[model samples]
Target: MSDGIPLIPVIPQALREAAHRGTLIPFVGAGASRLAGCPTWAQLADGALMACITANKFNHGQMEQIRHLSPRMKLSIARAIESEHALTIDYEKLINPFDGYQNNAVGHRVYRSLGKLSKTFVTTNYDAWLDTEILDPPLSVSTDSPVQDTVATPRVRRRIANVEDFTPANLNQENCVFHIHGSLVDPAGMVMTTRDYIRRYANDRGSDDPTRENRTLTFLEVLFQHKTVLFVGYGLEDLEILEYVIQKARQQFPSERPQARHFMLQGYFAHEYELMRSLTQYYAQCDIELIPFRRDQRDWGQLTEVLEAFAEAMPARAPLELQVQMEMESYLEP
Candidate 1:
């Protein structure tokens, strides 16, 4: 342990090694934002059903079973409502409710831990939780406030959402957050509905395509091929994105999951022995190592400690990892 911080045993050594080697990246999911008061995908989907009921639009055919529909299917209904009624799904207000949200201490702690872990982050979530919590301004920039984190560090710019933004020429400049599904900035771009997911998949050139031109696909493909990604803030139900990637990778590389160096931080209960075993077997099949933390009731309180330990265990790196190392030993001067 560096200094006196204890490394969580569940955090695999290879993940730490990848961190030191500058290959590990955190793939944030909705569960992380839920810590900060954002709605879960199920809750968000429920909003759609509630909205339909409030609008007196519920209970036609499958709409009769709207309450029972899965989140994805519920979102498909939302899309239909938006199309038919010209009603807007205020995702921003739903995501970042204008309550005492800024004072979300636990959420901020998690986001800050993420900042220390890596400069390049990938998240499927569309909220500005990370943008509000993580900052890396230039050292030259001075803040009037006494807060140290708001100044000179790994500056997190606005999330990169466009296909044009993922290029190494663009990403190599500074800290980057890749929001694979679009953020709240562009509702049209965000993948929420079933149709949206289909459209996104259509745009992606599969892993086998050497000549694929889509920047997002290339970025994901390259990261999976080369990096050890530790996926945090995901639940058993919300791992469709991770599963999608593995399936795609198998089309090209069938011997193992394409993301062979992947890991996920998961929560389970004391009584979920059988469930845990099944999940472990499933994740192993997908080539992901589980970093399980036991939780109680509705609180994943230990997740914060686990994240903190991960940040502390992984050695820090020079800025702009794709460039030369900041602490490099001397090579022979040419």
Candidate 2:
């Protein structure tokens, strides 16, 4: 079945339908912000280079000639920061602005849409962009007032205190967001350092300590329980995340009975087929439908147009019953 619309390309029909039904949960990744003039991972590496030089930590020319490093080498750079003190400084400098993008407009739109759609959310981003966008007046739980009740609003954002806070009640709220890697404003909660990723994912087996536990798995469990996941910014590059997700998901659902539809917008075409193949195997024990989006230009106008069309074509069901009516109102109200 198609949406019967030509304006929107139904490249991934299943995903289109799910998005319309509001069953599609978006998993925003770094690439989503690139279009809005933000830096990509390679750019971040270059930023790391610049940061190293400005701090007088490393010889700029050492990395000047190097355009790109292999994935293994990048991982090594991340790993080296644990012991190499100056490199640690370079790592923080590189990641600080990387985390700062959360406050940008691209980040704002991403989170605002999530507030409009997904039943719940889990972002690996350490920035407060998503939380800031959805949290009205943007109150921090660590602040004096702590929680601001938004039960009356169309959208509500709540900060997950720790692993123990990932209960059904919190996850299923009208519009809830959980920052798995923590946020920038909350330095103690931030998980940018290589040591943090290593410690969190390495000791990921269920734990009694609330703070030390793997909230990623909890998030994934809630994610898998859902029918569809719309992965936005995730590129499946981080070893800790890729490995833990693959390993834990396999262990939890040893059988292929309960499967969830997984969607990812692919920015690079040459890597698409290979990445999809690997993802299929990584998620072998779990059932998943990989959706790849090819964007020659970074406009992403095509993708959004398709999403708008899909959202338009959604069946007149409970959640989406007012979609067309809203469209009409949008056209007529003003």
Candidate 3:
């Protein structure tokens, strides 16, 4: 699954080398969480629209007029509605309309495979699919408090650092996930709208906030510079940050193929392969490569298998907790 069909030999081998060196960092996106029953950006903006309508800030007619607008633009309007009416929209509920979605089997497998692939992870999504223990193996606790143990223990190593906290120390911590956009843990801070993105990533050199100026920019630089990044689940539809960072890295680190270090797992039909040549060249210029996956159908159902392949390519290893459990079980009477 890793080597021959969709992924060429060079691509999988490159990923394998990175995994063994523990330098591979998976830059995850909404699609990864969507598999676990989370909503898309469009759905999120629609939720905001419904919230506005419920508050009488927007009418059905207004919703129809802006139905063609982009998700970010709708969210910008939603933010405006929030400001004007003082209505609070619950984003987490919108993200997961179906309760217990964190326990989706597909989401669990993807997250587990990701954990095996890299020590550090990055994601723009606000969902807890990547870090929560609900979908992962449970931690042992006093028999009296099963629910407390479930909520407290995280699957991947424990730290959840936000964008501002993307410091040298945080990145080095084993199994720390860097939530660049923001997380459900802080709803108000999630970067949802166009304005939110500008505020988050814009280079305000003369800003009063000395601690935050170019912080995200510099963090992105560090990632493209130091780590071997494999972008998973991004559709390349939102090319703003990815395009900027890769181009910056191209200039900052000039080499024969400085962009060769980054790869994106893109799904497409076999027929579309000929059409993507130009796009492939563009990605190459930006110092990024596409590891194209041929999809049998429209949906990306096979992504977990590819991720698992990358994980299995490295030396055989299990999660430390799982290892402990196995050892303890062996020592005890069955």
Candidate 4:
């Protein structure tokens, strides 16, 4: 089945088996949203900083200088804007233009391709695009807000506020969506600044700290350890999550090393052999298999075609109860 796509040289058999068995967990990143007209991280930061400069009648030269900086470096620009305006820019306000866009062709295709094979979707993006595509009536759980499960009829869609809301029973009940980062509805929870990342990931904090809780990181560790994580829309730039997975793997199997295989779909051109080879070796050390999609500059729909091909090759869906049981065991594993 994979032979149909000449562009993609190889698709791992393990990834196919995981998807067919409904054990594949999709870890969505910002690239997915960008396909739906949302700006990239760099663009989002630059746009907000530019707005701040314009509104305050600041020098255009500064805006241009900051615009050229990389996305991660732009945090400094955001800080500068805050210092000059004496006010923090609301990320939600900047993201307002992308709000209310419930449907996107690419998003719909992704959901359709995965079908009932996946019960849960995790994304770093703040957009509600996944809600539009996968969740009926668009339910979501945000790390920022709180949710209480009471003795009432379950709605078609729901949002979880934090890790406390996700019980083993709750996760196994039905399909769910998790916004590990802050969502659009709650801008304060969004991790945009350097300080936000530091606090969220506990960069300087001790693991035994009595006062701090890094629920998101803890959740990720468990997820990666158990699930056959299929990374979509991730550039593999964030080492924090990968590092946590590596740490847990080392701790669990110290003597006899076990391969913790994960998969990532990445876009690359023919000329970038060195780039591709370097990424392959890097992820290999982390026990990740990198699948490359040959992107033609003229063919915008190439990515969609690759995803569709993968969907076609996947085996028939498994029963819902069986799917839940398999996932549940991962959480219970010692």
Candidate 5:
């Protein structure tokens, strides 16, 4: 029952403050989805390896050659796979495992909670869980047939334009789910090899597409303006994100001056804590604080209770209050 990973207590108090303020912007990663039964990135890597074996193009030898490649280095896996085609490799193999919710209980609980609490989300994983759940409630949100689908092939992908179509008007529904890496169901989705990360974030192509560029900039603007970011599922393994957050903090707090407002949310993983420290030190000018949580401490149920308490304590913020009410009704509805 014991996984070798060390457990650390994420700062629960700050998380509480964020929830109440409704300024908490959650950036979920693969780990968050794991609670919902989805495979981890490493698991997906193994599956891709197996898919290569099944294709028979790569005997045990070729598979060995590509085995060392990281999950992001999936292009190496593609080369080993029988189908050298990008879409084929992605769709037939890497896509299925992350397609929909892996289990009903985990999916329903998490999505329901997400529906209730979060207004905006950014997930690194390619799963459609959030997209499917948005329209249908307890069911998968990613599966809801989008009003339009322009993806003609697996190689090409599309971005979910904006929340205008889905968000209710009177509600001032500023909340949205942004799939930074794209989704599994959408072939044009952003999932790609290690080179993709280099091309996208590292190389600054994340802004290449006008829409993507605008959105990324907007996200940064909102973040600087708002000053609260809840990091879920991110292990700090991605240095690019570390760099971005640091830079954003610096821009907000230009001199040796303290930041007007800025905070972060991270799971109670020890590595995450270390990463947080390193980041703060690197961006010493910006007084960014971190809120951490250990989901496994009492399961997500307890986590929700804590977040709810956090939300309750926040000073009155009308916009977030309205969003919370709408989500609560939708979640509690029979």
Candidate 6:
């Protein structure tokens, strides 16, 4: 069924090379979790806002106003709820629904495939699905749970909240799962409100502030600068982080040259040539190559098919003889 879906000619080979070279990193988005029964940002925000308004016993006029707002206006609702209730919305509650939901086939396959290729995974999701279901066996190496591996073998199952925690040692160890926007384990760390966004992306506290002053942005810049990022399960609506990174890149690297170390797998239709062209050019400014999976229908199953094909096309692990030869060559170098 998925074979009918089309991809840009060079995407498969390009992705294959990155996987073989261990340079490819998966940047998961909310769509991946949605596949696993988790709600989207709009859904979570709308639900939480409605609950808060009802709990507070607002007047009929105010209640009607809240009820009439579109789901897309969730952020605004969240802010209103915060102001009226004087309570911080716990986004962890939204992620709780995914706690025990069985893994969706597509998400399971995508992550399993990713685990075979790279050691590090990065995402903005608050759910624990990636840590609990996908990157499971390695046991999340940490100070409390140390991993025993030789230099030739690296463990990549650890999860970190902040970008600063992604140290040189962690990067070298591989298999590090970074939740750049906090995880369910830490509700206080989650960035949900408009105030949180301002603090994270707008406020500038100079070089000393970790909350602002471009610390997180710099971390992303450094990460993207060195790794080949493959963006999966993301749509145009989920462009906040991508847009921020692009803005930072432009400010940091003002050169006219284009960079293309990142790729995004998105769905497109046959008749949307103008839209595709415009989006391609728009992302080109950020040096991200957009690979569109041609969709005959509007369903998301095509994404799963594309991912499955991509994973299947990845070259198998190097042969034992080649591994031994490489090890011997490295041993002789010193």
**Highest TM-score, which number?**
3
Greater-TM-score candidate between 1 and 2: 1
Cα lDDT for residue 218, candidate 5: 37
- lDDT computed for candidate 1: 0.68
Write model 2 residue lDDT over 92-181, tens digit each, in one string: 344445454443444444444444545556666544445533433444566566574331222335666375676544544545567766
lDDT per residue as tens, model 3, 62-100: 999999999989998998888888889887789877774
Q: What ordering of candidates by lDDT runs from best to worst? A: 3, 1, 6, 4, 2, 5
Q: Which prediction has more favorable TM-score, 2 or 5?
A: 2
TM for candidate 6 is 0.74
Model 6 agreement with the true structure over 1-334: per-residue lDDT tens digits: 1243365334556667767766577788887677666787778866676666666634456646766565446555566657666766666666656443343545555555555556667888877656632433344457886774211222336778874684433443454678877887776677766667666665253446555455566556545655568887788887766887557644655654433278888777766656777887888767788887777664556666676566667632432345335534543453
Please list the C-alpha lDDT of all candidates, in the order they appear: 0.68, 0.51, 0.69, 0.61, 0.49, 0.62
RMSD (CA, Å), each prediction: 6.9, 11.7, 9.8, 8.9, 11.3, 9.3
Residue 167 C-alpha lDDT in model 1:
59
Per-residue lDDT tens digits of candidate 4, residues 174-253?
35667777687775566677666556665322356744545655566556655677787767556565665455534534
List ranges where model 5 is wrong by over 4 Å.
1-18, 75-87, 90-102, 132-172, 202-218, 244-288, 293-334
Every model's TM-score: 0.78, 0.62, 0.80, 0.75, 0.61, 0.74
Ranking by TM-score: 3, 1, 4, 6, 2, 5
Q: Could you tell me which residue pairs clash in candidate 6? A: 119-175, 156-175
Q: Candidate 1, residue 176: CA error in Å? A: 0.8
Which residue pairs collide, candidate 3?
Answer: 259-287
lDDT of 5 by residue, 256-290 (tens): 44223544444444344555556556444444555
Minimum summed lDDT over a 10-residue window in model 1 is located at 325-334
